[model samples]
Target: MARLVAVTAVLGLLLAGCVDPHTWPEDQDDIVNGPLEVRTHWQAFTLEQPLQINDEGRQRLHLVLDGEQYESNDLHDPKDYVNQFNPRRVDGVLIEPDIILVGDNGNEVRVHGTGSLGVRTGRLILAFGTHHGDFEDFLSRPPAIPDDIEHFEALRIRSNEPFTIEALHWSVDRHPDLHRCGRRCTWLERWLMGE
Candidate 1:
């Protein structure tokens, strides 16, 4: 009886260790690097400065989602005519930016533009829980752009579970000397001119 009890206690301890929180798989890195599809739409409000022009002599903004590429000629550009419109301002704050994604049971997610920059931008991804109410909880809040985010190409969403990015809305501080020529103009110019 004594020997059997000792064996049972050892088994219990091992089982408890196996269930330890530290033993749980860390999902952060996987979520950040996992395969994802993100679709974003944006509307611009305050253009405090002149529009930055590309090598083609057209204004351009590099828009990216889950490795997909897009460009905008103007801040007011939209995916479709019906969906595209100028941003509306409330109390001097622009409130027209939104994003939606199609995923797992057509789950729709929306993001509001918080802020942005020439290097990186910030947004708030708001998740609405589903019928089960299991997934309705808020995911990770948006973090300030890290120093490594040098450009839009480096932007990524870090999450644990499977997540679909629905939309992004934000304004950029105007690129400087947009009227200038050569590689110095805008990020688009640098790519186009291969400078």
Candidate 2:
């Protein structure tokens, strides 16, 4: 059964990204012109379904932390130098509400950002670029994520789909999974997956 299942997963070709996938679905009405500026975001998501981000969702930065409502100032304050998760800027769209993606293969990833869930082609990808710091900084020392802010425990994205927060990176160490080049996976996610 195990071998059969593994073969099935491979046959599925569980590719998680697309090239030039429309930022918004063709059916979705155009809301902005010439590349909508999605600024002040930190994390991002690969979505499966549609959801809403109302005024409150937007104001709250679209994150639910510690089961409590979390909000983002989107102020991009200098004081937030220690917190990479703080309000930052990225160019993307929120096709839906935030939810983590857990593949059938036990690979998982999460994206935290200004606010949004994503979708494109047949797959959904909501991406907000993270400030991994300059090339030198990344190789030497990735920017700090503030000791005060809780990691895995703090992020709680309500979702109906099966999910996995326990595995920090995707795929078990025994086997390697696909690397999502586009919005499907962020640099941080890829790094974590390797670890």
Candidate 3:
């Protein structure tokens, strides 16, 4: 009976168009819908402090970027840096906000920035471009973010230039039983399916 059941399960998976015998149905589906940016060079930094939960149950923190501290072609000052997160959502799933621009001048400090939660690692990448007058187009776009990271805490902008601000993320282990079929299973399925 055990061997017969195993054969039937393999046949069912094959009929569902499972190309690789090891590829589960859930592997073919992407539940998180968001535009992810890939990056190669970024410096890792430890979280300055542990995450604090707010009354709303959302986590929060602050990342500060001081551009003036870095050597740059232009005179880096704190007021020159500015950024924005364009927020959007689909079917109640919150999409990752876009970091429109990060500049050294003609921009205001944003109270919040983009980030990902449950990430084990975090990074900082520098964007290209020099400072141009507000009338001219010279502000640099936000650096690319890794696909797996999500969650943004607060942003604290001061008089600085050429600095990257990033939030901490926690990496979580994938749940073994939470798949397409849902959470709970019958005793027979649990016993025979090994999940």
Q: Point out the higher-scoring one by lDDT: 1 or 2.
A: 2
What order do you get sorting by lDDT, best first? 2, 1, 3
lDDT of 3 by residue, 74-170 (tens): 1222233332121111122212222221222323122233222211232221221112133132212222232232322222222221223332232
Of 2 and 3, the candidate ranking higher by TM-score: 2
**Which candidate leads in lDDT?**
2
Measured against the true structure, the TM-scores of the candidates, in listed sequence, are: 0.18, 0.22, 0.17
Q: Give the least accurate 10-residue stretch of model 2, judged by summed lDDT.
A: 166-175
Which regions in candidate 2 have their CA more than 4 angstroms from the true location? 1-71, 76-99, 114-195
Give, for candidate 3, the lowest lDDT window spanning 10 residues.
25-34
- Model 1 clash pairs are 99-167, 100-166, 100-167, 101-166, 129-136
Per-residue lDDT, model 3, residue 164, is 31
* Candidate number of the best TM-score: 2
What ranges in model 1 sit over 4 Å off?
A: 1-95, 119-195
On a 0 to 100 scale, what is the lDDT of residue 19 in model 2?
A: 31
Q: Give the TM-score of candidate 3.
A: 0.17
lDDT of 1 by residue, 1-195 (tens): 999897657544433332323322221112122123432333222222222212221111222223122212113343332222213222222222233322223333332222222212332222211111122222222222233322221122322222343233222222222322343344544443234
- The alpha-carbon lDDT assigned to residue 17 of candidate 1 equals 32
Query: What C-alpha lDDT do the candidate models reach, one value each?
Result: 0.28, 0.28, 0.26
